[model samples]
Target: MPLARRSLIEAAAARFGWRRAYGTTTEVDQLLNEQTETAYRDAPDHAALATAKNTDALTVQPGVLDARGRVLGEVLYLEGLLAGARNRRLPQELIARLEDVVDHGHELTVLLADTVRATAAAHTAGH
Candidate 1:
């Protein structure tokens, strides 16, 4: 039934300007808004979250192992150079080239690890 009604009493109320529309926030809506704000306000700092995130990334993610593998590759290359330096009378030019190779490999590994970490950070951040 319309609030603006045909009954004499309702007509009298409407005409007398006593009739009114009413509304209130639903409990669920109010609760949701409150809980959401509380959750956000009480949440940990972004750096803390990222540290926790990277800890997980270092353990469970395959990228960590891939990063380790790259490091190992560089270490082995450098180890060979070291062994050659100690054992054989190797050419200076050859040693220099091997040093460059190992240095480049190390740089590449660091870059790859950083990329992997950034990817993990993005995932943890819900990006």
Candidate 2:
């Protein structure tokens, strides 16, 4: 997944004619890398929350909502990035890749939202 993410970043950089200094990383790159790693680390927790039947709803619901919010935030961020790329008149291929990334992010948001909704429904039904 990191390789795929790096390739996408490289393609975007190439499209924008961005040059990086040797042996140095930009602040923006560092932030993005950190966010990607955080998302990867949180994935297992999200899955566990989704499948947690024995856990209390009060405990699981917060995690479900938090995961959903994070994914939704990421989707929004990607949408903004895609809009900026489009405004800059980037190549169609690069634009397409950005769109694909945004779409995938949206899918993740949807899945997390579903988990949140299911948790809510189960909680209500139990009470």
Candidate number with greatest TM-score: 2
Give one digit per residue, the lDDT tens place, for model 1 in 1-127: 3323424655678888886332455644654676698899998796776566656443435645576696877678786866787478688776777777777777777777776777678678964
Each model's number of backbone clashes? 0, 0
Candidate 2 minimal-lDDT segment of 10 residues: 19-28
In order of appearance, the predictions have TM-scores of: 0.42, 0.56
lDDT of each candidate versus the true structure: 0.67, 0.78
Question: Candidate 1: misplaced stretches above 4 Å?
Answer: 1-64, 67-71
- Can you write out model 2's per-residue Cα lDDT over 3-96, one digit (the tens) per residue? 5786688788989999644344565677578779989986766555456654666567776678888878888988998999999998989799
Cα lDDT for residue 14, candidate 2: 88
> How does model 1 score by TM-score?
0.42
Clashing pairs in 1: none
Count steric clashes of candidate 2.
0
